[model samples]
Target: MRAMAYRGPYKVRVEDRDMPCIEHPNDAIVKVSLAAICGSDLHLYHGMMPDTRVGHTFGHEFVGSVHEVGPSVQNLKPGDRVMVPFNVYCGSCYFCARGLYSNCHNVNANATAVGGIYGYSHTCGGYDGGQGEYVRVPFADVGPALIPEWMHEEDAVLLTDAVATGYFGAQLADIAEGDTVVVFGAGPIGLFAAQSSWLMGAGRVIVVDHLEYRLEKARTLAHAEVYNFAEYDDIVVELKKATDYLGADVAIDAVGAEADGNLLQHVTSAKFKLQGGSPVALNWAIDAVRKGGTISIMGAYGPMFSAVKFGDALNKGLTLRMNQCPVKRQWPRLFEHVRNGYLTPREIVTHRVPLEHIAEGYHLFSSKLDGCIKTLVLPHAG
Candidate 1:
């Protein structure tokens, strides 16, 4: 099997590797058909996440056919086309029973925080992801869903992470009808979050980013107002001015570790590794929203200290909600939305690369070249 292996920071390559076999009774080996390079994967590519070992494959969003399954995997059989959520979990745990699949206690040894995530890092349970020709899925019954007959393969793959997480971020906002919502990044998640806010009855949606291309996507695809943070002297003040000086009713942080507005914060966290992740987006969200409004954080961050505005959040009585999204929990409504033509997840896809060219794919996405909003990996492509 050929898998994308992480060699070191800013380095990866396609290398021949041993195929994964079923190691647990609930496991299934999937022959990956479609996979995506998520924006969060850049964290590992840039050495932001801790314990991302060399030779580990990095991908979490994928859809594939079951090549083999263990005896205990009763819901699926060989050749079943399925979309696997990014979470790896046991369905009967306390957290899972409560629909908090991302925090399942039985899966990760380090379950004090996040549960098992495919191909994230050692801190995320050290599982191999689906960027290769094949991947082993644990607790197969709980995580892998058969792709709906009406859904496109591209849509199914994106639903595994980006779409689901974005919808979950909007749900956390608890947006009231006619409320103004401002999203702090125009990446896939932020675009989806901005789009979902409209579905949740937000009167206005605004997407903020430093890139013109992504802001253009936010405007056209999400049907939301867009702003380039780089053009503003103080983006938070600009956001407040846009909201008539009271601030937005809700603000979301979709930019995590590598946020660029504050050079010192970016240097301290992303460059020097002194903190977990740069909290510039979150701080901006806190300052841009009304005092009693909500702030939803869907961005990926490491499990360490971050210089954030916790005191200000408390003083303003802001509701701060954040977690690694429970992906499966958001699927039912999302499926309905997709079926009704309310969302075209595949529209965000800008690049598709063969498995052999995935190193180039990583480079394209990481460098934000070629107007790349999203990139998909074809593991079995000819």
Candidate 2:
């Protein structure tokens, strides 16, 4: 099988690798039919996960047909198509019992929280990703992934990560019928946040991003008001005006470490705040939100042992809720949203390419120089 392997910083290559086989009695081997590069993938692309092995396959957001299943996997069969959750979990764990599968307490024991995940590293359980032709899924019978037949592979792929992230953002925000939501970053996660907020009954959803194309997608495709955070001299003032000075009840920062300006300046400038891949977005979201509001941070972050605005949080009385979207929690509901047509989140896919062109796909998505919002990788395409 040909899998994209991490070589080092800003490097990846499609390399021949062994096809994964089920190792656990409850495992299932899925033939990846549709997989998309996630904003989170950028971490490895940029070598943020320093702990990730040199040649490990790197992807987690994918949907495919079950190629094979172990004898204990009774609920799923060889022919069943499924969406794999980014978080690998043991359903019987303490955190899993409490509905926090990401912190399953059975995997990534060294992690401070429930931290086992695919395509991550020793800090995250070192599970191989699904970016290749096949992937091994442990505890598939109990993990958040569900085999839904009513959905297309392309559309259902997001149930694993992007859609769940969006749903989790709304869930963390406690979106309600009358609450207003402001989502930062019009990237894939941001777009999904806007859509999820609307579905959860937000009176108005306003998404912020500098990209013209992304803002357009938010307006016409997602049907939400947008703010060009670039043009606004006083973003707080403009957002206040849009929300009648109360500001949004919930503010979600979907842009991770990429929130800084030029890499050179931001790297050399004041190094305060969370020192992860995308903490600037968090700062902006905090200041943009109202005095008392909820902020959900779902953007994928690497390791950063640092402080991030505890004073502002203390002063503003902000309720900060964050996670990797905990793909395990939102998978079921996200699948329902897609199957029932409540969230057409796959609209973010601007380009689709075969597995042979994985390099080009990475280029298109990594730089995002074009209007490429989401790039889907086709492993079995001709």
Candidate 3:
């Protein structure tokens, strides 16, 4: 098998590796059909995530066919095409029974926070991801669903994480009818969050980012107002002004660890590793929302201390909601949205790279080169 191996910070390569075998009675071995290099994967690539061991593959968004299944995996058989949600969890666990699959208590050793995630760092769970020819899926009956005959493969793959997480982010915002929603970041998640806000009855949607390309995507794809924070003297003040000095009704933080507006914050968190993640975007979300409004955090952050504005949030009486998204929980509504033509998830895909060129794909996405919005990995591409 060929898998993407992490060499070090900002380094990765596809190399031959031993094929994964079913290790649990409920496990299944999936032959990778399609995989994606996600924004979360970049945290590992940039060394922002702790315990991202060398030789560990980094990928969580993927769709594939069942190559083999253990005796206990009764729902699927060989050659069954499926889209595996990024979460790895036991369906009957305390959290899982409540539909909080991302926080399942039975999986990961460090299950105090997030549950098992494929190909994420050891903090989430040290399971190998699907950025390879094949991957072993635990609790196979609970996580992987057969791809719908009417759905596009690209859409199925994106639904594994980015699409699901984005919709979940908007759901967490608790948007009300005719409310104005502000989204921080124009990445795939932010774009989806902005789009989902409209479906949830938001009257206005605003997306903020430093890149013009992504902002343009916000305008066209999400149909939201776009702002380049780099062009503003104070984006928070501008946001207030745009909202008639009251501030937006809701704000979502989709930029997590590597937010770049504040040099000091970026350097301290992303460069020096002093803080868990740069809170510039999150703090901006805090300041940009109305006093009694809600803020949703969809960004991925390290599990360390961050310079958050907890005091201000307390004073303003803002409702802060955040969690690693329960991916499968969002699928039913998302599938309907996709089927109803409200969302075209594959439209956001800007690049597709073969498995052999995964390192280059990582470089392209990490560097934000060539107007790259989303990059899919073709593990079996010829």
lDDT at 86 for candidate 1? 98
Write one digit per residue (lDDT tens) for candidate 3, span 1-72. Answer: 999999998899999999999898999999999999998788788887779899999889999999999999
The predicted structure with the larger lDDT, 2 or 3, is 3
The TM-scores of all predictions, comma-separated, are: 0.96, 0.91, 0.96
Runs off by more than 4 Å, candidate 3: 259-277
Across 123-207, the per-residue lDDT of candidate 2 in tens digits comes to: 7888888888998988878763555556766777877888788778878887768788888888788888888888888988888
- Quote the lDDT for 167 in model 3: 92
RMSD of 3: 2.5
Q: Report how far residue 364 has shifted in candidate 1, in Å.
A: 0.7
Error of 3 at 5 (Å): 0.6
Error of 3 at 173 (Å): 0.3
The 10-residue segment of model 2 with minimum total lDDT is: 268-277
Instruction: Point out the higher-scoring one by TM-score: 2 or 3.
Output: 3
